[model samples]
Target: MTLLPVDEALERILDGVKALPGEMVPIEEADGRVLAAPLSAMRTQPPFDASAMDGYAVRAADVETPRAVRLRVIGESAAGNRFHGAVGASEAVRIFTGAPVPEGADTILIQENADLLDDGSIEATSTVASGRHIRRAGLDFVEGDVVLEQGRRLGPAGVGLAAAAGHAMLSVTERPLVAIIATGDELVRPGEACGPDQIVASNGFAIGALAKSEGAQILDLGIVGDDSAEITAAVQRAAAAGAHVLVTLGGASVGARDLVRQALLDAGMSLDFWKIAMRPGKPLMFGRLEHRNSRNPDSTSRPDTTGTMRVLGLPGNPVSSLVCAHLFLRPLVARLGQRSHTPDLRAAVLASALRENDDRRDYIRASVASGPEGLIATPFSLQDSSMLTTLAAANALIVREPGAPAAEPGSRCRVLMLA
Candidate 1:
């Protein structure tokens, strides 16, 4: 009978979570890892002022006339080769791209825009602007500048930037070792036969896969039943194995056979708040567990690691569990990974009229397609909390607020993208 709004719950959960520890990882294996520490440039980019074109490096004044001016080609310069001699007033250096610009040469006349005269000299055919086509020393970045900040996810562009700034290894947040456990007596593994009330316990597998996608190390603990002792034993064993976070499915609500709440209490977790004002995921629990093997110090001088185990007790319904994971568990993992880049979730309006806005906030399954006016989100006709097929087909959520007015076709509505 208690429910908190979406944004408030997210903020509270984020405030309580701690970032994962940092570790040194090789650059070759660094894509998608969150940077734990800011990286400084080891050496400046472009190290020296280099030519930016395959042309003649000359003083701007020498190329003033396009047709009749004859300039002697003093020496040849290519990439990695520097012209030691300076260009005279009417002389130019043959330079290729990435070659160091010769002394006293302030411009590059592109070869396409100039004709090579008969005696290994060059004839200027266009007026050249000074300082054109030149990559100055440290043009991109200077040494010791902070190139990559902490909490950045290293994608391809980020990786390329890091490499350009002279980093071969990066210090990134250590991937938190998380253990996922699903519990239900009526649950059977996929590829197995099902009795009257048996489900495949497929949500756990899906969640584990999603966690792995976020670069978290997942330990799939398989399934446990409705037995309290078995569940409690599994919880303790997972904690003992140094798991930073333990996510469990089922037994979160006030059900009679529900054992997750009791098991979490036995493991010394101070339950925060449970349940939220959202459909398909109302029975969610967030809390921290005190170490089962730590000694108390009279409420003072506590160690950093003790009482720091994080746990999320999710609902048993597959759709609800996955939705709750998206709301709570994914952010928890991202925080631990020190990933500051929360995927940019943009909002869009519902394309059609919506009749009912229930008393609770709704994340309706929807598909989005491009319209002449941007993305148009269309809600799926069938939305059941137990229907995973509908969830699979959906790529977004029409975020309907509690007690919202009946919406018209072109109203400004918030949509949470899922794709």
Candidate 2:
């Protein structure tokens, strides 16, 4: 089969994808969650006209002139407490910030601009304007006003806004659950002893971390040997757990021991596409499986309801798997989380020369630095797919398109920044 282009591959993977069902969660637990629907203000903010400064509430006409005006301190008003009586001529009400403006008061005289006397009275030293230093009713937001739009990720400010809008709970998209399976006879878990030919499994942990960063719940299914039966069982377990996405580490290439594809096919998965035209991730595979629950055996009472589970078969090489995850899995999780799936690419200048590219696109690990011209992307000397240390030390991936010509230092390039 011809290698699929990167853009075509991504389009096919995300076609018709949408966020999962919504769930109601308390505002306290809504942080980092995406809003399933537009959130409207439940009640008006500052329902009543309130003071904005610590001072006395008086009629604007009483303190409009520059000359000092003395008025008797008739009463006081505080937050959540209001003075019932009106501010008569030559009378003022002592009010603090956030306190409701007493009836018949049109302005606030800041205490710094007022002089207190031995008697229960204050003399205003500055002219006051009408409606000054007062937060009007519905100043921030009014009831039924949309404060946050749908598909918005709730952050600190978003949560605070929801709280201020009188929402104790919010409707947010349910986080996607991802089930990860690693396949390889030569693989072993970390912290365990391994033979001379065996190595510790690391792709599952990296993939799980990537998924979790995108607000996805992870179910690591541990390691399975190169046996087809074990692979089929792992797939079944993922379906049983109702995972939205199943990420398989290794066993995707067309090698003798690569049994993931055949096992998935046996498990009733329809292959979408495989073998992309990208370096370090050419053997990437995507497919979908129809999951049916056999626990309910009654034909009439339990209808055969089938749900689709997405499958992503990643290469065995650690760097290749991680790079593929960044390109594909991250966007998939973001789509399920009700967020726009777009890579954060920035323009940068090449800090060193590079040779002509092959048919496959390359994601060169590089160190990105800010310079006088702009961002500078300096790729590492080694570009091997098996080098995990270089990948870890790099802060960005310099993108190089297929069939591109040789480029010199200071040439413009595009880079995908890694968080």
Candidate 3:
């Protein structure tokens, strides 16, 4: 089969994809979730003209001149408590920060600019312009104003703004459920007894972490052997659980024991692509499975839904699995959640010489550091896809295009940051 370019393969996978349906969640739990609808302010911020500093509320005319003016402190206005009486001529109200400005008061004489007199009155020592220290009603937002637009990810500031806008609950996109299935006869769960030919499964956890970081909910289907029936059953289970995407860790290549691709096809998955022109992840596969309703007429089992679930078959090699996920799975999940996803790509100077590349695109793991000139990306001596240590130690991947010429030290290049 002709190898598909990485860009073409990604385009096929994301074609016609849309975000999942929205659901109502409490504001406390809405962080990191995308807004499904425009968030409007329910009430005006501050609701009224409020004091911005700890000072006395007085008419601007009362202290406009530099000369000291004597005014009686009629009442105190603390937050949540208001001085109902108006600040008439020569009358002042002791107001704290965030307190509502008293009626007929148009300015605030900060405490530093006032002096406590021997009598019950306070003397203004400086002039304050009208509306100098007052936060006008609706200063931040007014009622019916769209504070947060749809498709916005609710970060810390977004959540705070939503709460301040009087939203106890927000409408947010539902997190796509990404079900993972690890396939290999020689695979065992971590911490379990293993034979000489077997290795503990690690790809699922890594992929699951990456998926969660993209706001996807994970359902680990555990380990399945090379048996086609078991793999097909796992696919059915994923569909029954309403998973938005099914990620198969191993057994995707054309080896004799590689059965994941065929099993998914047997279970009604329509193949989109089977191989990608990329190093460390050439055997990657993508497909879509239409959910089927197989429930008995009177059975209590829920019928399979109508939506189609995406399928991603990744190589079993630890590094390959993670790299493919970073390239493919992250964007798919972000698209489904209606969140933004952008690769951290940067230009750098190569610190060492590199051999001419093959037809396949190469992702050379490298360490990046700030140099006197700019970013310097030094490729690790080892480029084997099976070396997890090298992948873990590296902070960036130097991207080399297909059929590119040899690169020498100090040459400019592009990289995708992994740190």
Candidate 4:
């Protein structure tokens, strides 16, 4: 089969994808969740004209003359408390920040600009203008005004805005549940003893973390030996658990022990694509499976019954699996969470000269640094798929188009920054 282009493969994988259903959650729990609908203000901010500073409230005309004006202090107003009586001529009311502006008062004379007398009166020392140091009603937001739009991720500021808008609860998209299965007879869990041919299983942990960072719930099925029956059972368990996306690590290539593909086919998976024309992750596979019984075994509370479960079969190589997750799985999770799915690519100058590329697209792990000319991306000398140290040290991925020509130092290039 011809290897699909990276762009085309991603397009196929994300076809017909839409955000999941939304659920109502308290504003405190809405942080980091995507808004499913527009959030409107329930009550006007400042409901009434209020004071913006600790001062005395008086008519502007009463304190406008060049000469100092004296006024009797009749009452006091503080936040959540208001003076009901109007301020008559030559009269003032002491007011604190956030206090409602009393009736007949048009300006605030800051306490520093006023001198208090022994007879319970204040002499204005400076000319004051009308409406100064007063927050008008609905100054921040009016009732029914849309404060947050649909599909926006709720950060700290967003949550605060919603709270200010009188929203105790917000509607947010449901978190995507991702099930992971690791396959390989030569694999064992971390901290376990291994033989000469055996290695510790790390892909499931890394992949689960990657999915979780994207706001997806993870269901790790642990390691399954390279057997068709065992692989089939794991796939069934994923379906039974109501996983939206199932990610399989290893056993995807066409090796003798590679039974993931055949097992998925036997378990009624519709293959979308098998391989892609990309470095580090060439044997990636995507498919969909229909679950006969749409019930969730993990939770007593039932979610919406979903007919099809998306499946991603990744290579056994550690770096390859992580790179593929960054390029593909993260976007899928974002889409399910109702967030934007576009890759964030930034332009940078190559720190060193690079060789010409082959037909496959390259995602070279590199160290990106800010330079006088902007960002400078320098690729590591060694890019072996099995090297985890290089992947760990990389802060960005330098993107090179297929069959591109060689470039000299300081050449312009595009990079995907890793968070």
Instruction: State every prediction's TM-score relative to the real structure.
Output: 0.86, 0.93, 0.95, 0.94
TM-score of 1: 0.86
Q: Write model 1 residue lDDT over 1-419, tens digit each, in one string.
A: 65887778778777766787776767898998989899888889899889989999998988877865788998988987788889888898999999999989999999998788678888888898899999999998899998888888889988988988878889888787777889989999999999998878888887887777777888778889999888988888677655777899988888898889888898688887788888979888888776542322222342335446678888888888888887777777887787643643666767888877777788888888777877788888877888999889988878888899898877767777776
* Tens digits of lDDT, candidate 4, 21-84: 8988889899888899999999999899999999999999999873366799999999988998
Summarize candidate 3's per-residue lDDT along 1-419 as a digit string, tens digits: 67899999989989988998888889999988989999999999989999999999999898977545789999999999999889899999999999999999999999999888889798888989999899999999999999999999889999999999999999999888899999999999989999999998999999999999999889899999999999999998888777889999989988999999999999999999998999989999999998854532223554545788899999999998899999999999999999768999999999999999998989999999999999999999988888999999999999999998999999999999997
| Candidate with the larger TM-score of 1 and 2 | 2
Local distance difference test, each candidate: 0.82, 0.91, 0.92, 0.92
Question: Which pairs of residues have clashing backbones in candidate 3?
Answer: none
In model 2, what are the clashing residue pairs, if there are any? none
Residue ranges of candidate 3 with Cα displaced over 4 Å: 293-304
Q: Ten residues in a row with the worst lDDT in model 3?
A: 293-302
RMSD in order of candidates: 4.7, 3.3, 2.9, 1.9
lDDT per residue as tens, model 2, 297-402:
2123434445788999999999999999999999999999999877989999999999999999999999999999899999999989888999999999999999
The number of clashing residue pairs in each candidate reads 0, 0, 0, 0
Please tell me which predicted candidate would have the highest TM-score against the true structure: 3
TM-score of 4: 0.94
